[model samples]
Target: MLLCDTPNLVSSSEVIAGVSDHDALLAELRVDSRRPTPLPAMLPNWRRAPWPKLNDRLAEEMHAVLQINNLNDAWTAWKTTLVGCVSECVPSRKSRPKRRLLPWLDKKLKKMIKIKDELFAKWQVEKTLESRNLFETARRASQGAVRSRLSLPAPRAFPRRKAKRVENHGERRRQLAIHVLDAKSATGPDDVPAVLLKRCAKTLCPSLAHIFNLSLRACDLPTDWKCAAVTPIPKDGEKSDLRNNRPISVTSLVGKLLEKHVRNQLAGFLDTNKALPDNQHGFRERRSCTTMLLRTLDSWTAAIDKNSGGHVHAIFLDWANAFDKVPHQRLLSKLQHHGIDGAALEWLKNFLVGRSQFVRFGGARSEPCVVSSGVVQGSVLGPLLFNVYVSDLPAVVKTNLVQYADDCTIFREVTSQDDVDELQEDLALIDIWCVNNGMQLNAKKCVAMDLSRARQPRLPQYMIGGAVLEYVSTQRLLGVHIARDLRWNHHVDVQRKKAAQTLGFAARNLRGCTQRVKRMAYLTLVKP
Candidate 1:
């Protein structure tokens, strides 16, 4: 390609780049050496901050926030000192350019493209219409590659860092907790942003780590840490209706550093001792809703194949306000059963009890309400503690219960009518367990699903808490739609509609946005 009107046209030629074929050129060369892209303003790369200067400055003025008597003033002063120290000591560098994404193009497309070029060359040499038609056909054949690239997104895996046992385990935990604070997260009631704390983490970590360690030593946290500012977010329907919105508690951002550390220790202890059952997949590391669904579906498929024509009957149960219904006494008892006692257990007890919340709507805040039961609403330990609370849920069915947090399901291979009866008996046992634990299943919302090929003419009734469960042909369990006939048409159609809705919404609302931002619709397509 040549710029026909350009005055300084010394030379232009293609260079062999590994990314491109011999017949093609992927790189663009322009002799504009005099003009260079100006570097953007330098931002502090705190990850490589000067630690000696940071520590010295931090240690000097950080005492202003160490007053345990007035935590509110201390926290405010802490943020100020951190900001000062970070600005003074942290080094700044030119922002690095974002790495360009060049997803792989398959060999089949390359082969077809080569063939198309060959046919086009032949057509040019022989001046044959048939060769030209063959070249055109090969060009259209590459649309499959285009569609494949657009429709399917390769799953990206991130490498995880594991904890190593060091001499100062407590110090290490505090450092990590402070370090991993989400930079973009919304701050809690204290008005001190997590992002601000994160930026100064290098300078603030040692001092923060010491404060956290003191809390652990005495097995007691500050009152301010236990306090939360609750904000009601609309879950569905009208925003004006308070019932439609669920309370999302925002505990102190500073407190989260301590909370996360304790949560990790408790989780690690549970994982090491294997206190949590295989059935309970809630909040545990390396376990997710997808894994739970996979394990359940895999076992059901195996059972069906082994029995030659077997089907699995499953009942999905939802607990009413499960997170808010966990009794403190019961949770402590369960923790004790799992062999967590002495200082560790005492720390957990203090962590749980004496927690209070006040709803914040607009400018005014409601009176602080003392919460007696259930775990902290928005804390890191909430779900883990909830999972532990119901860890002893009966796994009476053959499939040994599939659970993710409060979502519970029990399934078994139904060889005969007796097998279905056995499943009902298991459900009865679950009802009894729920009653004992001060937790009851929302029987009205409970649904029964049959993962079977053939539909039974008269499906047997299943009961929980004297309420008959409704059976559904297609039930969505943990985000994935499960059909009795095992077809993905409904699931695919639903997702396609959602993506279309999202795309349409973006296009309509983002008319004022720049091209780069408007291109988010394309990224949204690849996101799912």
Candidate 2:
């Protein structure tokens, strides 16, 4: 969605106009309740072509071309051929099944609703006691039927519960705050269609053929094309606080596809060469954060089983803005040290330097700023690049290191003060490595937990950077929660409650849906 390099400044009046238009459309949808209205259609896919048919056409085009002088030319021709064929032959998907938000409205209910509306209309016009009574009775019957079908408790006037209305009002305020900037920026909902069209054209064209050719080297990237648009999202706290914001980059879809293609090649190369360390499970083939957590848990369980009374000191490292703060120069140096060179090294340098992004809050955009450090936040190459950047940590520190991306944990079997002192030395070595690599440990966020059958008579003081680490009874890694004692009870309980809440929402809204629909919704939303 971050397709535009530059955005025009928008006025508040233009935004208000769009919001008013949107509100009008929503109001129109709510006007009629007696008869079912046709559901709105899903947006068209501008780039979705019939792959089976298009592939044959593309093959014929490729076969007709006898010679390509440059690798860049070949890549450009291939992309052009694909776009020309696809743009002409793109097929439409089948229409989605119509859905009703209030699915419980049947013929009988519809009749009752119609009657209620008629009586209400008459009461409004006549302003008579008899007309009002008729309207009230019809409305009560219609409302009761709805409540009965949805299994909702009867409405009651509870003075104390009136306070809950404040919560609803607060939610409206939050939505308004999030949308105000967007509305004022003159970026309307129609921007998506325009962006998609532009993206399609850009992909089909050969403006960056040279960049695509560099992918053959599988180490480097193209120049200005690699810059990403960064947007800030609040990190689950008070929205007013700037500290709670985290920038997430939204890059070009075409660029992402190229990056993925290059990533696959580099991943294979790294795997075959065994250039990456085994301790690193991030962005590698057949490795994930979950896998890393399971391995760490396995090690913890094994140590506990081997020595019932022995303690394993587990310290989870937190780097402040790990991806955003990566020193580009240091990262490139690390890559070179790991044997990445030639066109690939140059490409990486071009990819990292002179990148500019403007933050977008709703529709309003800030002035363009240069990004001097870090990997692109949402880039496919980011995790792999980070892994390469920190791959030497195991060599730098003599301890059991388990890493999944930037979520690193180092632990050692501890008994006496000597063991604790040695662990502190290992921490210092890691800190030094981080500094050398243009990374800093967030000591405040970093946590230490002692895993043992029995508590040690004395606990060790752990310090990272200049700040001491806090000891926690439990911490969540990946999506799984782990207690100091390594019990699954906390995780199980949390998952169960979440599932119940999801199911409750599904049951309420999906009351009159078909059994098959209900089951599908449950499996898709609640089960996971």
Candidate 3:
């Protein structure tokens, strides 16, 4: 009964009577080759567009000031005009005689997948431990072969702000476009290429500014702009499971350009009001993993250098799905506390609420689902918003804390068992904070590392959410590994081996490529 009409799909059908005590039909399909995936007819060939004429047309149309009445209508009109200009200048991608196949799934990946299927069949039939293990190994290899390419509390009475208009947003818009709008970046769901915006920034800034000002002044975001196009990238796990993959969303880049402006304003407000603690090292200007590690290590070394046989007990807290679990109402309340109120706060509320996202892999797409919680995954403002959401986390932790966004490392200098008890109390308070804020702490992955030179080092147990944290003598903090003996040999060796393997892969594939390509390969693959 199994039939396949497609040329690429070669099918084999069989009937077996012994399988289920009845005649069972078995069908197998082999996709050895396929034609190129046809892109949506709407996506224009923007790279070959008449950019100068496009710019001139956009300028001529948008030179006049828009008389705004209804916000959505205005947005719709602008989008229509923008589309019209593009249609006139840019050629459709369908104009091509034949499109080439995408090279993401090659012969090697196909071969590995075939091996994995064979092993799976063997394991299913034999049902032995060794066979199962071999199957799992093959599954992991197939997964790897395909993967070679890719908080916070509400505040009480806060200041209500008078709305202030952005001054000279035209110039600011032009500057932001020049810096943040990358020509090479992916196009959003709107099918507008970033190259179009970046190249025509000079001519389009006025109209863009007008649109942006309308959004800010009216405290409204367009419906299309809020819809995110999500792309799921494989993570370090079995790729067959959806939960193991990471979702990176591509929201409207035009919306994101406005987000950048809002981000700057919000950051300035936080800095002026001192809302965030210095312990936060993620997403802030001039702070990174290395800086956070240096400070954490400095605190440990200082604690250890003291003559009282003082030891530092550190617990690295992991927030489970930290970005995805951010509550929108809680975030807005915190933003209000941080002096972002009135128009800015309203704009953010509109931005975060009623958003939808659809997952896209190649030419396929999932249905768009409404997002009730969490900021957009691959958004320009997600990190900053999360930081603001958990701004008060450091307050609850009584001991020394180093935070890089959600990855919090809490430690204390312990001279006696009483100090350990005090640190334990701090951990209890953090657990309570997570409960009150709808955040889950991954205590199973949490670890307590005691930094001491003493032969008889006291490593105490820590508990969060009734789960005991494991004790570890060696842990990787940031990218650098920390050992109980404070040696760098293991870390250096691991990095060396990783670099060598990556270099070999690059070299094997890049034999006939140019020197420039080889250099880029090294920089992107091996050097990093």
Candidate 4:
């Protein structure tokens, strides 16, 4: 019984220490196999003794008999006596009263009786084993077999490969070669190589020259490049003349204003406190600048009038791996052509070097560690540097192209099919520019649509191939969510009705209260 309850017993040290005393009693009962000779020869009177008190002796005796090593011996002794009891207690139908008299005896009944006898014999054997001195030994051996079968092997581990020293050396050499090439190419304004300028035109302003100025500034070009030394000759009778070769200084009042406005708009997003170094060891300051530039371009585009019949054509360009694939020599030449000078150029060169580090989590006592690529997103100067490199393309193509980061949009005044064809040619040039700068045009995202159709009261929808382009009205941009069937005015009317009902209910309730108050005042006066 104690062995049966052993699983439930909680020990101060371990939960299941050993078997219970009930098991010992069962084992002893099975071991005592001697029986009374016959019923007539039995003692005149037989009485049951009081239960034995539990003590250290009983525990010692049980421990000796139930040793795990002697399990088989104990089990065999218990089974012998158990089998004898089954043979005597179970009845044999062959020796039963005549079945002809009762007429109910059959083979099925005999089979059932035999089955019962067999079951009884098995139970008696189990009970005898349970009462044996080696019961605990038997139980432990059985449990051990089960545990051995269920046990799993410890997992094998593979050794990690050490980073190759030769690989690091090669990478360093490649980086050094790039740096040397960039330095050698960095010369004067005209020194900006044709290839670099062409790339910049493609990347910075494939549609308009105005964006070139922004890209130059974003790139941190030298002071000289910030100003346009040559001015454009105005059209006949236009506001400005072509002969004016005065240098347009970025430090000038208008230039400063533009810079200030762009910075001010970006201030909300530029969190200096959170800025960290990126994987390339550069800070990400350009994201804010890019955002500001895009917003400014959007605003400028929206200001164009549709009623004047001035059609706008825009294309957004996306460069694949813009930062990673930047040709250092080409970029340097572009910077030189733009007028980037000594110290600024040197600082940029140093900024390109990559650095790495490891990171850990959890606490001092129990911590987990992991190795990963260094910070690449939250760096303070990372965005600015990236924007500088990316802006070069738009700057050179600014004659007709408008670029806000990778998003390029070309606008043209279209009247006829000839005009559309001309715009397409210009767009093709823009695509070529992108290809030159290691950028690819994703044709799926690129769209060319007519603003005239878009401006209609109920605009006729257009599709590129089979895919419908979303037509957004200027009015819809002003916080109005437009659906196919629902109009803004209809929503406003519903809101207005709801508001009026709410006001009417309040007024009615107030009127009732006011009348009651007046009546009370009159009653008080009359009572007085």
Which candidate gets the maximum TM-score versus the true structure? 3
The TM-score-based order of candidates, best leading, equals: 3, 1, 2, 4
What is the C-alpha lDDT profile of model 2 across 1-528, one tens digit per residue? 122222322111122234444522111111223533444454334456454565456556654332554544555565566556655666545455455555566889989999999999999999999999999999999988876665533233322422222234533433222322221232221122223323333232332333455455544433334555566778876555688888777664445545665677677877787778998988787888878887888988888778768788989998888888888988888788877788777767777777777766543567878888988766778888888888778988877999888888899888788889888999999999887777888888899988877765346789988888888878888778888778888889999999999999989877755576677777778888
Over 1-528, each residue of candidate 4 has an lDDT whose tens digit, in order, gives 334333323222323434764222222221225532322222111012111221222222333223323323433322233223223333323222222332233455445545555555665687775445344444455445434333323223333645533244533433222222222232222123222222222221211122223333343322322222221233434222334222111111222222333333333332342222111112234544345344533533553454444444433334443444555555555545545556545544433333221211111111212212211122233345454455544434432454433444454545556655665555556566666865555555555434432343322333332443344432221123222222357557555676566656545533423444434433333222
Give the per-residue lDDT of model 3 (tens digit) for 1-528.
Answer: 555555334447788776566687777766436644646455578778888898888887765437655667767777787888888888877643344643556777778889889999999999999999999999999776654532011122334756544457658645565555667888888766688778887876766777888888899988988898888889975545588888878878788888887888788878888889999999998899989988888888888878546678889889999888888999899888877888888989998999999988767788999999997767788889998888898898779988898888899988888998999999999999888888999877888888877677787777888998888888888888887655678788889999999999988876655566677778777887
In model 2, the runs with Cα more than 4 Å from the true position are 1-119, 127-211, 214-224, 455-458, 507-518
Cα lDDT for residue 51, candidate 3? 84
Candidate 3 is scored at a TM of 0.77
Off by over 4 Å in 4: 1-310, 319-325, 355-377, 390-400, 453-528
Q: By TM-score, is 3 or 4 better?
A: 3
- Assess candidate 4 and give its TM-score to the true structure: 0.29
Question: How many residue pairs collide in each prediction?
Answer: 0, 4, 1, 48
Residue 4 CA error for candidate 2 (Å)? 41
Residue 217, candidate 4: how far off, in angstroms?
Answer: 24
Q: TM-score each candidate.
A: 0.69, 0.66, 0.77, 0.29
